[model samples]
Target chain A: MITVSIEKKLRTYGGGQALKLAAEFLTGSVTKIYGPSGAGKTTLLKMLAGLVRPEKGKIVFNGETWLDTERNIDMPPQKRKIGFVFQDYALFPNMTVREHLQYATHDDAWIQRLLAVSNMTTFTSHKPAYLSGGQQQRLAILRALATKPQLMLMDEPFSALDTQIKIVLISELQHIFNELATTVLIVSHNLSELESFDGNVLYVGNQ
Target chain B: MDLSPIWLTLKLAAITTLLLLAIGLPLAWWLSRGRSGIKLVTEALITMPLVLPPSVLGFYLLLAFSPQNGLGKWLLHTFDVQLVFSFPGLVLASIVYSLPFMIGPVKSALQQLPVSLAQASYTLGKTEWQTFTCVLLPNIKPSLLTAIVLTFAHTLGEFGVVLMIGGSIPGVTRVASIAVYDAVEQMDYSSANNYSLLLFAITFFMVMAVFIFNKYHAKSPLE
Candidate 1:
């Protein structure tokens, strides 16, 4: 179970204001963060990932208090056990696909499964730059899963891929999620992508 | 052709380049990621020696490291070390003189890195140091090479700082640049010509190698 109630401010076009005004989420199950662009979706994800600190609030995940700014308790991102797939798919450019998958996991079997599931076995030696957009996104997803976190946060993971590749990878992702039972929170402006994801959605907007 | 000065210059360049890399990498990382005000101040300080005449910088360093100064006194009494008119002193002065050559390319390379890369590494359960060594260092290879070559070449050709602090002590602080100057001053045109040609050839080759490598494998910061 994850529970978060955060209040933070952000700078707007000309001035600073309460951009993330009173955001709240209480979920007993895996959830998705569905919102349009500039809707503070990424901000909320960053906060949940422990990358950003809320001005005044608490974030409790799996009975552990990850953030309590009032109490001066803030766990860093590494301790949060939350995996984030960046919008640009921040794969280490220097590492091969196999190394990327290997970085977050100790289980060779699981890595093999991930490579086979993502259909990246053939290009395991290639760097991220050599992979296509869809291939990179698939590698990013698999890399996140390699960590075996309780929750995964993906920010527009498929925004860069073509329609066909997006559909195929999404199905593969659904199968992997079902098999691992890993909770996921994906942020995307694409409503159709959210519809395909088998999870509850957090619709974020201005109050 | 006297090979001693040539050997001395190579040794100085190698030592100076190694020292600069050790010192400059962390300094560049801090400057790249620090707050704007701090960054500005440090940037100005690092580049100050670049724009100023090397003689002026060397003069200040000489005073600071002289036996009369507090640091020099401590070193002399505690460690039995002297900074002025020594090979190590020449190295120390060369490091200061060639600091910007090491820092500039490194700073720019580190600055061009997207914060997302580090953040991603953090999210992957790596500490700041691990991320810096594994991800940041590898990505900035070109810049690191440039820093090494430029700092080495700059130290090889260093004259003012060596002249001011090193005092042309043969077999101790008399590096090739100072030796070349001494040769010219003594009107030993053949030896001076030999040293000058050697320096010119070395610097030309190193600079040419950097440009060629950059041309073939120009790394985009995003990559």
Candidate 2:
């Protein structure tokens, strides 16, 4: 389980708005972070991933202190060991799909399994530029999973997929999460997108 | 035609370009990451060569590295090396003259890349240096090519700095640009034209290579 109480001042067009969030995410549980646009949803995920720092707060993951401002203990993103699916996918243009997975882990078995799970086996030799939107999204998810992170933070992971593909992929992801007992925190602006996710909802609003 | 000047120029340009690549990569990476007063000042100093007259830079470098000056005297006493009016001095001068060309395009491309790319690498447990070399640098090949070719071509065409610090020493300080000047002074129009034509052809091809690389690697609509 991870406990977080972070206060970060996000810059807005008008000025700065302090985003004060205090929450807990249980292990092996899926939590859908639902919010409006510019509601610091992505920032919250970034904070959890150690990609962004909170001005003041403590983030304790599985009883380990990932962040503690009072003690000045802030772990870097490289040590966070979390998988992040960025809004833009963030796939390297030069690397093929298989190479992307290889870069994250040396486990060839795990890489093959991830490619199979994401239905991206045939596109392993293709670079991101040659992949379709849905294919690219799957590659991003597969790349994130290649590391076998305990916590998976996805930012609108299904925004680029078709409905049929989304449903099938969601079922596959759910099966994999169950098998791995991975905790997931997905931020989505669309409410209906996560209807089939069947996870607890955390609606981030103005503090 | 005394081809020694052509060979000397190529040697100087190659050595300077290689050294600049080694220095500029780390310096540009540091400069591109964040903003600060120190970084701003350093960037301004690096950019000074672009606008400041080559003679101005050469004059100060000449003084600083001259055996008569304290720094140069210390160097001469300690290492028995003289920079002013030497081939090493020409290389030093060329590096200073072409620094902006090496750093500018690479820095801009590094800055323009999406921050998420590095973040993704980080979350994958890659170290900062690993991410920079394996991830960031590979993606910016077009810009890297431009920076490298421009630096080489600019170093090839450098004149004022080389002329000021490195006097016309045959097979040593005398490069193609200086050779062109020397030939023109002696009313050797044909030799001057040969040197000028070579430089023009080399620079043109280098620029064309940059254009072709950019065209091939241009990011298509990823969405």
Candidate 3:
């Protein structure tokens, strides 16, 4: 299970305000995060992934304290073993599709399996520049799964895919998440896109 | 054609370029990523050579390498080495004079990279060094190449700082630039013309090659 209670100061266009959030995620369940623009949905994901520091917070994952500001205990992102897919699909420009997976793991068989699941087998040597938006998004998802992370945080992970592809990939991803027994958190403002996810929703906004 | 000065100039540019890469990588990385008050002070010190008059920098360097100053005396007493009027002194002066050429390109390249790339690497369990070498270095190859070529070319053309610190000594401190000055002072136009032509040809070839390579292979993603 994962538990978080955090507060952070945010500067929005209108004015400055404080963001406070508290939540608990079961060990192997999917959670969808939905909110208006600038509601700190992305920041919440970043904070959970250890990419951002909250002003005062405690994040505990499976009884391990990832962050406890009062006690001054903070484990860096690398040791936390979490997977994150950025909204921009942050693929390394210099690395090819195969190289991206190889960077995360030495298991060639696992890489081959991931490529097959993503239907990217033929594009292994292609760099991100050559891939279409949907392809790049799939690559981002595959790369995040390359390590078989126990916790996955994805921000609009299916925003670029067509409806047909999104449905098929989401089904495949659900199977993969179940097999890995990984707890997943996905943020998306489009409700229909995440209809197949079968998860609880967390809303963030003016409140 | 006294080839000794040509060889010495090449040697100096090569060593200085290599040293600049060693020093510039970490310094540029720090400058690009760090958010601290001390970064401003360090950046100002590094950029001093860019705007300050070369002769003024040379004048201070000459004093420091005179064997009368603390650094010069310490070097002499510890290593039996004299910096002033020596080949090593020429390299030291060239490094200072051409520092901005190397650091500027590298810092810009690093800063332009999206922060997500580094964050992705970190979540993959790669250490900072691994991320820098495996991810950042490969993407910024063009900038590194430009930095190297510019620093070498700049060092090759340096005059005032080298003159003040190293002085003209045959096959020791006399580089191609200094040799050209000496030949012209003696009305030896033929020797001066030869040195000038050689420098022009080599420096032009190197710069052109890098530009061509970047155009064909290392074009930025924005392009």
Strongest candidate by TM-score: 3
Model 2 lDDT at residue A130: 85
Docking class of 1: medium
> TM-score for each prediction?
0.94, 0.97, 0.98
Count backbone overlaps in model 2: 0
- Candidate 2, pairs of clashing residues: none
Q: Estimate the Cα RMSD of every predicted model relative to the unseen true structure.
A: 2.0, 1.6, 1.2
- Report residue B145 deviation for candidate 3 (angstroms): 1.0
C-alpha lDDT score of every prediction, in listed order: 0.83, 0.90, 0.91
lDDT of candidate 1 over A56-153, digit per residue (tens): 88888878999898899999999987788999788899899999877777889999988887778999999988998888988888888888777788
- Candidate 3: the clashing residue pairs are none
lDDT of 3 by residue, A1-207 (tens): 999999987766245866799999999899999988887888888988888899999999999999999999889999989899999988999999999999999999999998987889999999998999999999999999999999999999999999988988999899989999999999998977898988888897775
DockQ of 3: 0.71
Better of 1 and 3 by lDDT: 3
Positional deviation of residue B144's Cα in model 1 after best superposition, in angstroms = 0.6
- Sort the predicted structures by lDDT, highest score first: 3, 2, 1
Model 3's alpha-carbon lDDT is 0.91
